[model samples]
Target: MKLRLIIIFVILAVPNAWAGSQSQAEPQHEPAEIIKFAKDVEKYAASKGARAFIIARMGRPEKDLPDGIMFTHTAIAVYSNITLNSGEVLQGYAIHNLYQTAGSPDKSELVVDYPVDFFWGAHELKAGIVIPDTQLQQKLIALIAAGNDQALHNPKYSVIANPFNSQFQNCTEYTLDLINAAIYDTLDIARLKANAAAHFSPQRVNTSRVKLMFGSMLMDDVTTKDHKGKVYTTTFTTIGKYLQKNQLADEFLTLNSKGEIQSL
Candidate 1:
């Protein structure tokens, strides 16, 4: 049901490829409210003096999913102190997201981009923010510097990836595993997978059986395991629950389309 919407995100992830098809596809102009929301979010992070932040947004409207689940995607933002060639130090941020490479649609890779660039053309201006403690923030930076961030990725991109198993993974599932790695200071696949499943359970969206069957048939990587005749999939909201359960987030907030901030 949401297959077409997912393809839109894949197109946005690969701007170079999107450019080729821009004429025929008729790219939508980003809303002014969304741009304001992204800018204000960056400002809010700077004011908090956070080392890194977790961000979630409404990717698109998926009616098949359960109600009250507005957020569809998640990513990580890290603040860095860079020293230029001229010996000048500057503060900057980089957002990391899991995306399917344009050249190889079957493969998933980490995409590092500026905050505004990351949020460009988001379906909704609303977002949820998470600021980790100083200790965890440093760990996250170290993990990225060591090039260990790639260890948590599962090349196969599955929309209904089972969080308890490592057979396949989705964006939010990968983010949860990365957080688990930083928290334990270990990239052990077994440990990260177990912790993620314990702290975060997949959200059970009441999707129609027919739609679920269609998803399994259309998406080669997607599967609807017959576990007690039920289906489970990870979402941004599930990641929020895990952070709160483990107290991994020091501060959390929600930014709305109206340019208002609400602390969580």
Candidate 2:
């Protein structure tokens, strides 16, 4: 499960690639203080090399910020929309991001799905997470258009961490939801065609390139996604409608702070 979600995370990491921020103009921050903190995070992700997509969001919290400790925190959404050296872009997206809080003075963690997809890969992509579930989508639209920030921030609307922490300055009770694909570079086109025969459905799709198919699987405890190691009453169970495309970047999706598609 972890591997699957991780791979998808990388592909989804690119969209809306990590958002950029201009330093705070409100309060005068010391020049040295800002530079050192900035270097720490840049160094952290830089150590990961050039392949992984690293998106970092730095900002202060709206509630309960610590003293003496700089309030800005970093969440690294690492992604890898890897395309082989075919000299051509692959038809789909990939994902594998893990968020990290890389600031000073004692409070940091690697949030699995915070902030949003930074594009398709490290340095080159930052569009957003791409999602296929229609049901999950409608709910997001309603929440964003619900008119008031306080209302949208209602516990009932929380589905994932606000990837754009700048918009919604708070942690959430919701966990990120995902979807992704595995690319096959099988040699035998004949074998691939034969496999497509079994799953292909008469279901006409708007997608081009691959044969379409259908099936259903039981999500035994998907409702438990929000359990977080302990049970809590939740109306937040995710209902997934899964499907695959012959050619499309596979990725995870969640509602960003503004409830826009976090991964595009």
Candidate 3:
């Protein structure tokens, strides 16, 4: 009976980390509150004059997340001229994401959304923000503008994907790929992976092996085949560390629901 309960807990809890793009079926907060917070995040980024930056959202409650994992969904947000419903063009930030397909957690698609839409289904109103150095920022903008972001995308999705290979990719890993592509100025994924293996420090997943094994058995997106030893995957915090270590970031901080900024 204890083993059965453990399996059931794994089935229920594991997917929260593995499937970062899954949205809550119902709104957790009021629409007005969500929209206000999203705009606040945008305002903060704009104040920093960020042309392109890394953004993260909390898709699950803080207490439920595993150690070393701060945020769930990470993506790139580029400043752009957006066309609205009434054919009006306005300058704002557009987010690029790797969201798991509805009803297909194992598959993913690249999606571009605005701040309001990006945070609409968030489980928490907090955000993780990282603005790259000016030169790298320009490179990121150019890469996305030139449509190279799609070139680096791998639709083979995994929650705990190995960053040292091309077998599987999660949202944070994809963000890292884009950053490396910008740094190296090449779309060569092989070279990118090699560089990552050499320089990047992925977040180690701190969870029981038994739970992970059962999660792999029960969930399509929770497989550990790509990982050989201890499970390590790219995360928002790790990305910040990489950029800060190499002097690629101008700012790395967290934006709370109260519009306060705290350096990470």
Candidate 4:
């Protein structure tokens, strides 16, 4: 059941979507072989200065009926993110398709098989573990698992849209974004709320910027000049405004009534 709602994705499997460590040193692999070769390549990549490679699935329970055929399938989803030496980043995912076929042959029975496995070329066939920081990725995984369905709807936290269908757009990325938003937003807020004597304005227009731990996307803080070409109020919404390119994209532009600048 591919629901149309935004799913905070911890992981997903998408068409041709993958992120792998770029290693001229690592052994070469065919596109179709990536999934099956995950374990081996991950180890090899780790040895060759690649990041961590992980796999996760999503689905429901299997039900057995009177039929002799074994029919069991879950909404399968997978994700992979890796970092390179120069600090480049790649990420991708796909949704698992589980189903069965009736009357496969003359025999009176059904067969359990995936009719299709969603993947895309632009998304990479796999992801790397980001080898240097497994602990950080694991911590993020824990945070996402802790969030319930209700938590996904909150604006304060980056909404995890449908990862499987949203092209690996899981809540995991949103949560990561929020974490960054908090860091950058808080730093900016500190400057905005400083006393007049401690006031330090941005030297250039729209120079204040925010970045992510992985450098996936750069969400710019709202900034402009006054009629006199002076940097005026640099409003900050909260410390953590949830960093989605669209949702809280304009986050740092606004301020709460309290004027303390909320921190996520």
Candidate 5:
């Protein structure tokens, strides 16, 4: 029952608009399929001579979300040409994502770590990969190096964040902001927000009013606000659409639990 309630909370926590990892003490192992998918991302980037890619996975399903909307999390993966002491060029990758801290519901941290850690605990092994062009990839690398990505983060996480508003942010929003910054003059947050909303508008999901109220009341970060009127939230779907429309993505892939790849 407790688990059910938690799922309920996560599922209904959003309305429309809105809205990482690492290692430590003991080494944690991700599922075999996820690891394989990560490897595939690295290999694909290297093969295309691409500098960066975006990856998202299907987390556990939320009952409150509309059917067929499955992706729950997204992150950016960047490839670096590591020159070893032997002068051999080895490609190394760093994945970045924003995660909420355990101590406080409102506090979140930007995590930079390995690709393997990015897909940990995914409900299914499925993933969406977006490879941006060389110039855009260079811009993405700059953002990661200068910590400009942090500027785009909104600690106030919401299930359905208003893509047009700056008050809240989620993983997808962070990723979108990075892309926007790289593509346009990201120094101005107002322009970036406007561009993002123009390319992609969040979609609304229909749920019981009681569940919506319960979610807003029970969850510290969840709220109806203007979202109830807008009736939509941004997720991987919106992000994918923006990428596709802009012609920014060099390659896109969908991988299943068995590690099969299909062009999305």
Candidate 6:
């Protein structure tokens, strides 16, 4: 009975231990500080004439993240004309994301939010910015504008989703699928998976087999069935590396709260 109780405790706490994509209940930093950092990220992207770019945020503390994991959540930001509640039309960036459903981490939904809202629950005021080549950027903007982004979404959420398959998807994997759809000019899931397997290299999840096994058994969002051998998944850094390796990115960088820029 005692061993069973200890197992229950570990199962209940596995989600927090693995740290999947989820929004925070409260702001980690001051509201003003978050807003400023978010705006700074936008300004930096806009200054580079990035009509559409991939953005990432740290949903968990950097120290707590396992090795090779950098950011927890990723989305696409497109420059557009935003209409506020006051009927004011402002030119800014709007973020498109695949967020896990609240209270149902196994499911996900496509959400459109702004940079401020994107960073509202961030654990750190750091941003991962990847501006694709101008041609790819135009393609991405056109694809999303044509409503293909939603067409490519798979609502089955997983924390360690295998990029080579469409069985389940995380935010980063969803973003990668969208990018590939634009690049290949097709919404065919099979073809996308093929291309991903051939061209893209995913980041391996650095955790023990025992923990993963237990997490998969207990957590609805954690699964290893999709992975054939070593557990691997799409991540913000891997996406950047993919774009860079293919010469599809104009700039891949990181922005901090202090307005510092560093290459990824």
lDDT of 2 by residue, 77-133 (tens): 322233557866532212222222233111112223312222211221112223323
Task: State the displacement of the C-alpha of residue 103, model 4, in Å, after optimal TM-score superposition.
Answer: 31
After the best TM-score superposition of candidate 5, give how far the Cα of residue 148 lies from its true spot, in angstroms: 1.1
- Candidate 5 lDDT over 55-112, as tens digits, reads 7865554443465465767788887665668999876887787765565544567877
The stretch of ten residues in a row with the least summed lDDT in candidate 4 is 15-24
TM for candidate 2 is 0.21
Error (Å) of candidate 1 at residue 250 is 1.7
Put down candidate 4 lDDT per residue, 144-248, tens digits, no spaces.
345321232222211112211211222232222323323233323223224211422211212112211111221111112111333222111111122222242
Which residue pairs does candidate 6 place in steric collision? none
State model 2's lDDT: 0.25
Q: Which consecutive 10 residues in model 1 have the weakest lDDT in total?
A: 15-24
**Higher-ranked by lDDT: 1 or 3:** 3
TM-score of 6: 0.95
* Ranked candidates, highest lDDT first: 6, 3, 5, 1, 2, 4
- Which of 3 and 4 is the better model by TM-score? 3
All candidates in order of TM-score, best leading: 3, 6, 5, 1, 4, 2
Q: Ten residues in a row with the worst lDDT in model 5?
A: 17-26
Off-target runs (Cα >4 Å) in candidate 3 are 1-3, 12-18, 23-25
State the C-alpha lDDT per candidate. Answer: 0.66, 0.25, 0.88, 0.23, 0.67, 0.89
- Report the number of the highest-TM-score candidate: 3
lDDT of 3 by residue, 97-193 (tens): 9888888888889999999888887788999999999999999999999999999989888898899999998999999999999999899989999
Q: What's the residue-level lDDT of 192 in candidate 4?
A: 20
* Model 1 misplaced stretches (Cα beyond 4 Å): 1-34, 62-65, 81-90, 103-106, 225-229
Q: Which candidate is the best by lDDT?
A: 6
Which candidate, 3 or 4, has the higher lDDT? Answer: 3
Each prediction's total of clashing residue pairs, residues at least 3 apart in sequence or on different chains, is 0, 42, 0, 41, 11, 0
